[model samples]
Target chain A: MGGAAPAAGAPLVGANSSGGSLKALDGRVRILATAAFALATVSFSHFGPLLIALGGAMLVARLVELPILKTLRRIIAMDMFIAFMILMLPFTTLGEPLFFVFGFPASRQGLVEAALIGLKANAIVLMAMALLSSFEPVELARAMGRLGVPERLVHLVLFNIRYIDLLYRELHRLRTAMRARAFRANASWHACVSMGYLIGMMLIRALERSERILQAMKCRGFTGRLYLDGEERIQRLDLVFAAAFAAFVGALTLWEILSVAAL
Target chain B: MHIVDGALTLPVIAVGSAITVAGIGLGLRQMPPEKIPAAGVLSATFFCASLVHMSIGPSSVHLIVNGLCGIVLGWAAFPALFVALLLQAIFFGFGGLTVIGVNTANIAVPAVIVYYLCRRGVVRSSPQVAAIWGAVGGALAIALTTGCVALALSFSGDEFIPAAKLVFFAHIPVMAIEAVLTAAAVYLIRRVKPELLDAFSAASPDLQPVLAAAPEASLRSTQS
Candidate 1:
């Protein structure tokens, strides 16, 4: 399983990965391009187009200068979640028998469907990470704010980003304290009850911290209105990138339509 | 249980998206602006808590704790859970952009149901009783979430039936773990800071006087 714990403490505002030309594009443009890529990737079920989409995603990942091994590892970790589904589809779906494993026939259609889902999922995730993961979480949330996400929702996201690291540290401190007591977590009633108490303690502390934060904000003249940064005008480079991405997505869509009709 | 992109059919995705949007709208409506800080911090707490892995036999699993979320946040669990899902998708790619709607609906709808079912019991009962109710709510939320996931998969295609069954069965252990954790958490909250669970009632406009009176009594004692 992927380690979500490390990610929880990852620096949200800065990690200095946005070095490539693609990362330099406007956030809105990148967001739209990522969405377009996802939509186009998912619109097809054919193995041929899905392969093309995966290749295109890889190419984009290259353009974004993403760490290749790290990105591939992340994608493989995601695949583990669906591994059973992919494996089971071959035996379950009805179609011409491709082969037999343990006297059960694996259908050709099922194999195709499984491969298509895997490819489509990987393509979308790679392109999304390539295009948008470079931006700091705060930056992405701000872009979404400008993109007409409800102001309140955007504020909530911003606040979450602001506090996640702090809270994560708090959790770490608590866990460290537990470790000092030689507590070993296992599948036992005592372990579970102790873990439960840990969670409960964290939540109580969180609530009290929020109360203090509210008071601190009120002291600073908070009136429930948080001001997001001013928007950036789309640059010429952003327009060019947007138009190029649109053409690529448009071509993918056309290919999908023709392929489906051909079938 | 996080459905990836292109797995679900278009109609399932659309319906999921529509329901999620409506749920968020309702949740936001009930949340006053002054509560934003509280909601935001609590949401972050859940996000962090979900990252905590618990040992179950040979393998470990991270509990979603949606039952606890529902018990604490009420209708606002919708938006709070949505934010967590969104962050997870964007940062970790555990879920996809398009399927986020279905994922949120699967997790948060059960949370809301749990809230309705257990909130009254937790508020009015003793600590032990509230913890038992919390266990029920926690287990019930996971069961329902797994059911929703299976239903979403089945709706997508007959080919997904086995996968759906597998997903549901795989989560049975999770339900038990979450139940224990949620009960303990609720028990602690009920003992140490009952008002946190009473946030929904305290925030209700009509209940302002009662809420105000509770604090004033403490204020008077402090002054004296």
Candidate 2:
């Protein structure tokens, strides 16, 4: 949760960091970071003997002081239900009986499995945190394009990230206004309904705002395709970074393969 | 409520992806030129709405005003939402690539439902009636979407039912919050930007003129 504050509060870490050395290092470093991310994600999913390794990798990546973990904490806040899922996994899975309380038995295997699952989930989450913290939203959208995501899709994402804050501010103002008007009530469902209507209003405003924004963009020559300033050149450093990250992933994957083959 | 990759079955993801692509194609084909900007704003609004979280009891949930989206954008909301979710997946990784279809469907279906309901005069006719219907409809949409995602996950052989139950229950307070939020938003737009309603009404056949007389009176007063 501590990780989430920086991204949510600052909101421009990725976008504003596009200067000089940071700009130079952006592509290469992001490539390495994303490679680490992919490894971390795949490792988390398997979570057999690889839990400790994935966790270690995540901790090391976090130590790199990237903003990834912070942003991730904010995003993962939406998954509160997963907390209950984690809590139940240890008590429900089938396994050898390890301990008993009253008539219920705790399975050792279940505990171990659940612990691994937790570690894996956290590792994947941390990896995501790191990537988002380091890469600008626009850069990421561009990268997705390079990776074959559709042009219209990329445009939509860029605009969405750009204008999200405006909608939030509008909602906040409206809510404050409502409260000022003494729109208070008891715990009746009607009060709830009132709130829903307010949200609906926010959506309507958002639509109008988007229309204005689009007209603004069109006035400035925004075709369906997004055009970034400056030419994108893949440098020697980028190749080296990509190669090094690939080698690291390849080595770890080989080790995992050998370990499993040996068994 | 965005499902990550490797959480559900491959077949489920494949089917979901196909459906999402088809929906996007359909949405794109039907989008009016003037509405493109509105779609963009809705996309941004969806993105921004997910950021404002309020704690509900032991858990927290963010707002997703798909009902307003449906009412305003009609079928175009699907493509707009797809773009937003895709950004969320890549930029934030909230939802993974594999489940983009499932997540989009989960959110977009409610927007579509709200769109249709608004057309049917379930809302947009009377402020009081709209408020009540909007609240219940918003709650039902969130629940139904969550249920669909859960069912999809369960069919994929993941331990999804219990997780879904927990999610659905936790959402009870949040949904109520969302309901209030939606209703108030509608009421505000009704008061301040009444002409916007006319535009929406013109665009969407379902949203008939509820306060046609009020707008005319306001217009007459301004002219005088």
Candidate 3:
């Protein structure tokens, strides 16, 4: 959000999608925070603590200025899978006797497992939104590259992100062309074959285009390593943010360790 | 099917990431510099494949062409699929950022398996044989992927074993759809440019996939 009087959740449109000043707090720090939060929440075997962790993640997401609804949108997909698990797990888990559902037997441990999975998924997703979504892909790749990730993998990620949208558009246009040709595909084998033709055509187009792009790059003096511009150093504010997150991780880990020990 | 964030427990996540990291390392070592763009394009193709959905028996399912990728790209599918999976998570949130490791392993591991098992058959002169091999790779990829997803779920607790079995069962129709699609594509490619596909990385000459060895031997290739 811009200025002193901006409305709540109204982050300024161009105001660095990277969680603002907090987001600028170094890619390495952000990566660490994401991993630590994920590990801590995912380690929880109990349902009660998982709820607290989810609430804490939501609270942090709010504090760090991530859009809650947008974060929740990601959580929705996880919810579907979790829902499926809960529906199927209860009846099939072998454990101490629990209330019967339908004709199948439901186990207490199964119900707890379902609840933990749901809560852990939500919490981890929320933290990811708060910590990782802010940084752009290129920046994330760069951070990872610096952090000992293979250079080729980073370059692959860069190239993939750069071309992924373009290819998606190409696929859309191809599908449109098929539709224009009055092609109707359903669950039939004929439809599958038609779709296969479509994909084959798409693959040929993509390979040829790649060759062209490679030739163009070579013509313009290309090397195996793509050099990215910008040498922005981590500033003092970034250190402060990193320190805060580090302390948070320590506290969270300690709490989890104590809770598990008690259990 | 990409497993969303936090769906897996710590042990599964650690093992998955370790395997993925190793596989990508091998893939990079195997891939030559000139072939980078090819891998990138194929990665983008898989990325776009999500946009095109087809109806299978009772429901529609998006294509996860790790099998095809593995057949063509070999171990390189690790990095390619990893990049695709990451972008999917970041842009579409179809999967989660945190769980990219496990999802990548789940998809890419099966692909590499298919590559080793079926890449040879795919590059053959016989269209029917190639199609049969493609069908096997396609069916196998989804089956193994479903198993990986189920295993990841089961890691949360023993209570998930039945649910895991159900996940595998639910994908039986998807396996059929993948088989049909892959077989058709294999047939078409056999008719088209054979050089465009490679069963292994360009670096290796030992098993030089059928494409590299085809022209000199077969005068009659993919006619009609």
Candidate 4:
């Protein structure tokens, strides 16, 4: 765990399959349908619904032919904080004690709750990785814009994505330089101060550059709008795929509801 | 500090989203046409801040610096952080799209609070005073953020109280590291480029935006 690269903190998109372009009919459909399913998964809390959703989400991932294990690892790694908290529940939560781990009581209810969080988080993340990873960030932003999200919000997202990678690379280089200069930053006040100075320099540079970037944009006649060609309509294939995805999610949701009613 | 989907209840989601929308609205209003570029860049800075890991013991953790963002960007931290969260969801699957509202509010709201609580001293003349205030703001921001995260977690039910406690405890070290980092950063900026401390100081009567990176704002921030 200590050896794991700190890159997961920002987590760029290279872990994803870059599966396909969302310009394709299926890509758009996948985005639309998976988004709905993701929301549905969020609203759901039960273990059974979540387990079913996890299977369904995995199936969607398979449909896209995504690299499954890699994406799963990335998901778990990114969510380690939440995972850590959930893992603690088994020891901390009071219920019928099933066993002991390190002399702490592990309970049945706690184990079930932990499983629910794990499955729920994995299902949502898998669906996201499979469907959303198909498009580049710019393409995804455009698709989101076309999907009726506010243009301001869309542009904000696009602009940030536009700069995140370049800035991250700069940060990596700067850190390397610091390390070269014998900046170890190892659990000390001096370490924090060194890192803080580094961040301050980075922020100051970015602040100065913003003015020039704006002027360059103005010179290029970049009005407040980001205009891109080929905002395509939803094709028949997209509709069919969207319908199928909807049906799968709907069926599961209905089953969960009915089962709850029965209970 | 990012929460995944299915981790929050409906009322929590609803209230969190509503407050987030309002915050962004305020942020947009604060960001003038000329300032959007600066906001964009600052947004990117905050976005990338997470990737900058300060080594500790055998491992490392990235800086959240929402407190620093708020100190510098004020309400603009709203759209700044919102964009970052959205891109992370899209590009990296770090957090889910459904939870964007809750996540943004959780991070940015505390940032805005710190802005009110600490931005003045950050731009103050005395570096020690500025650093002290920065440290307070930075450490307090994480505590507040953890509290907000816990609040959102508990909104689903009482079952999440333990998880909330776990989150708060886990972040104590981060909070201290952040305090020192923020204090150091505030002091350095105050020493190196004073204008930047007031570049977005809309509330400060003594200073105005030097959007062009001209030396005049620096002169005034220094003199005043």
The candidate maximizing lDDT is: 1
Error of 1 at B139 (Å): 0.3
Better of 1 and 3 by DockQ: 1
Candidates 1 and 2 compared: the better one by DockQ is 1
Error of 3 at A81 (Å): 2.8
* lDDT (Cα, tens digit) per residue for candidate 1, span A1-263: 31344455356323225637776677788778888788778888677778878888888778778777767777887899778888899899999999999999999999988888889888888888877776777778878878888766877888888887788778877787887898876657777789889988888888898888877876775655557665677888888888888888888888889988988
Worst 10 residues of 2 chain B by lDDT: B204-213
Best candidate according to DockQ? 1
* Model 4 bad stretches (over 4 Å): A1-15, A20-23, A26-31, A45-48, A102-104, A228-230, B204-224
What pairs collide in candidate 3? none
**Over the stretch B141-194, how does candidate 1's per-residue lDDT look in tens digits?**
999999999999999999999889988898898898889888999999999999
DockQ of each: 0.50, 0.27, 0.36, 0.44
- Candidate 3 lDDT over residue span A1-263, tens digit each: 00023234432111224474465567777777777877777776765567767777777677667665756665685577457766666677778758876667888877776676667767777776666667676787788787777666777877776676576666667777777888765668887888777777777778888888767765775555656555857789768876776776567667777877997
At residue A111, give the lDDT of candidate 1: 93
* Alpha carbon lDDT at A179, candidate 3: 76
Model 1 residue pairs with clashes: none
TM-score of each model, in listed order = 0.92, 0.75, 0.86, 0.88
TM-score of chain A of 1: 0.91
Deviation from native of the Cα of residue A152 in model 3, angstroms = 0.6
TM-score of 2: 0.75
Which of 1 and 4 is ahead in lDDT?
1
Candidate 4, residue A133: lDDT: 73
Write one digit per residue (lDDT tens) for candidate 3, span B190-220.
7785666752343343454453344223212
